[model samples]
Target: MSVRCLLPLVIVAIVAVSGANFKRREFKIKIDGEVSFKATPPLSSGKTITWKFKDLQGGVIRVMDFDYDESATPQNPLFKNCASADKKTGELTLHNLTENHSGLYFFELNGKEQMEKFPLKVMRVVQKPEITNEKTTSNPDVVYLKCKYDKVVDKDAKISWSCSNDTTEELAYTKTGKTDLCCACTLKNDVSQETSDQICESDLFHEGSNIALTVVLILLFILLFVVIVLVLMYRFNNKFHDYVFKKYEKTTCLGGMLKNLDQCRSGKKTGVKQTDVTTVYTEVNKIEENNKEDDPLTDPQHDYEEPQSGDKQTDVENGTPLKKEDNTPTEHSDDL
Candidate 1:
């Protein structure tokens, strides 16, 4: 080949070789910890990859090496130093691992391929699980049981599910990115009245972490008790009002007074004569006046003063003065 033709050919060969190496050298990240599962990155066809862990002491810990065959028995690499891998699924497990095992790892594919670096984050599983019930109603068709941790857990960690009252078993569906996991269960029978006594529990196992849900039910019971007390108080107040009205009816003479007055006006029998009414009214007035005079608060002289003797004589000659009692006080004349 001519010099110019050879240069283009050489460049094409170098480009082809670099492209092949790039595909084979693509690195994948695997996160492992006390409770984390092995995570594999998507790999291209015909690629080979190996995992090596680098400790803080600069010591290289060989994890695993495997070829990327789309139809391989163990598709994922199994690190003898760490844990084994499932044949069916490409899941890797790390045993007796700590956070210090967490760091950057390097993967070397085929010979003459560049090494690829990945980050292996090792997280401590939550020691205790926090369980909560978010249902607000007394009886709910479905109840949410939330199992959460204070921090973010590994996304590929294996979680186990269980309950306190074995009458109903809980199942965990998926892992949440926020280190918390939640599951929903349908209530088999009506539990409106029975929820106070029944408790729901969730157990998460990074290393046997568990949480119970009983405090929420206790609070609901206290609220129900308060409502019952208020209802009883309202009933008592209504009964008290009725009792007061009945007592007042028995003590007062208003009924009797009205009945007597009605009979007198209707004239069913011989009613009181006008003269008799006038005489009785005059006697009652005299009694009321005597009572007033006896009271020191009343000035009897100002209330009943007599007219002069001259005025009385003139009134008598004119026939305007009625018969007067000699024993009556002089103040009585002024009153008339």
Candidate 2:
């Protein structure tokens, strides 16, 4: 053969040997001391191998079979030919092994046995340091931060808090327990008007952990304002009532004074010359006369009157007789 043709053959032979060596590599495994099982040797293509377990007394107790790869392993194959006790280990070899082959293998010796559970799990790497902020008041002086997590685990967890604008070193925290965790940080001294972008954060090992809180202070302020207004209104109403009563009393007093003045004016306008007044005066005079008549000693000549004489006397009284006619007075007395 020519040199070029011979070189190609040599390269192909080397590649075939390398592939076989890769397929025959032994699988790494760690077993629990309570369980004993035979480690089966790697098999070639289209071949099967059996894994058997023995008790402490060296008696065969259990057996399991596995088949090698019939086709080339795909890059993302769902199943692989490897068995381990921990989930972090690789996939279990199950070429011919169906659903029935999946279970714990146990061996009994002298009524005592060891059990080996197979097909470890493969956990996905999750994002860490799940951070969130609680709802807080805009008054930076009265606010605080609270951090929490959804679940607890054995791994070492860390928490970090920092102001958004300031690049200072962050505050760190650590905790380990079976219950949920929380922490409070006061921002009274640390916060200012310029620190409006303040924030709080947490670091956890698992995903979906979160924190939340709320502040409601405006309602209290509104309640206080309402109380003050009510108090002021009550005081104003009381003062107004007192003023109204005073005005009403003054009006009543003025009305009484006007009534008295009207009575005095009416008396002056009507003089005492009417018939009723005359009759009253006559009755008063009659009463006085009756009282005088009842007293005899008060009037001595009540019925006395003057006598007249005619001209028929003798010669001695001739002068008197002759003047008899003239003796009778012509005017009568005012008493009659």
Candidate 3:
């Protein structure tokens, strides 16, 4: 397993041996070495008290007894880990606790009722707080920070946050397992007053100082990627423009009427230049006017009305053509 993954097991083993190898500096070793208990009111002189130890795996055993009749028993040599008690005070002291001492211990006054219970748990000294930056912390105004430490015992440890602004904030820690507290906070954009730098620091422990660097690198990489894409798009923009213009210039597909008109003109005489189109239309109009003037039906002097069908039929039977008589209508014979 990786170092980070195996770290917890190693810390637990150290804590497993800490009760014997090293004692907590804050508490006296004598007091730390053993658990002491005494009955109230000096045990009332004549009354007695009994101390019992319940090893979770080994079963329950009576450690010692104090008698009001001046007969105070010594710690059972059988247990080897307990010491004698004061007969007058009815106090029981458990000494030189080892790994085997982890269990429950209780006291009984005069062997009648349970007076107090002691649950002994051995723990390793808490290491310095380990701090790490949260991964989702992308905001510049507020930075997310996390503090975690090994917890070997049930005792509560303090994790405090301090800044140069003369402010002390107690960080609330959440218990993850039997021996771990993971706490997080969103801090202001300003540098930590304690670290004397931009990063946060604690009196007991200081976390890795490179958290900010990693975040910066990630952001720079993302920005570089965006810039590259934009440059590529700009480089080929001319090709895209050419494609659109050429496709749109295909008049046959868009302006059908104009395309047909061009085809019709191309099929005509080659001598006729497209520039002479206006002149050709003017000449056609003059020819139409001359034809109209030559037309006999259009002559101003001709008083011509169309002949009746009957007249035209008779003329046809007689096989004689009708002549224009004076200022009247005319008929035509089939014989003519």
Instruction: Tell how far residue 66 is off in model 2, in angstroms.
Output: 5.2
Candidate 2, residues 157-276: lDDT per residue as tens digits? 233344323222233333243234443322212111111222322333222242222123566678899977744443346564334434443466843443343344334456423224
Q: Is candidate 1 or candidate 2 better by lDDT?
A: 1
Span of ten consecutive residues with least summed lDDT in model 1: 188-197
For candidate 3, the clash count comes to: 1
lDDT of each residue in 134-229, candidate 1, tens digit only: 543554334455544333443333333443333323332332332234332222221111122223222222212322336667788999999777
Position 93, candidate 1: lDDT = 47
Once superposed on the true structure, which residue ranges of model 2 sit more than 4 Å away at CA? 1-46, 51-63, 66-153, 156-170, 173-239, 242-336
lDDT of 3 by residue, 1-336 (tens): 799999999999977676443333112222136666555546766677777877769698878776776755555564554576777677666677565666676777766766345566643333455455533324332334444444443134444454222222333222222222223322222111112112422312223235667888999999999977744443346564334434543565643432333334434536444444334546988999888777877767656677685564336668777764566545754446
User: What are the Cα lDDT values of the candidates?
Assistant: 0.46, 0.37, 0.52
Worst 10 residues of 2 by lDDT: 186-195
Higher-scoring candidate on TM-score, 2 or 3: 3
Clashes of each: 3, 4, 1
**Ranked by lDDT, top first:** 3, 1, 2
Candidate 2's TM-score reads 0.19
Of the pair 1 and 3, which is ahead by TM-score?
3
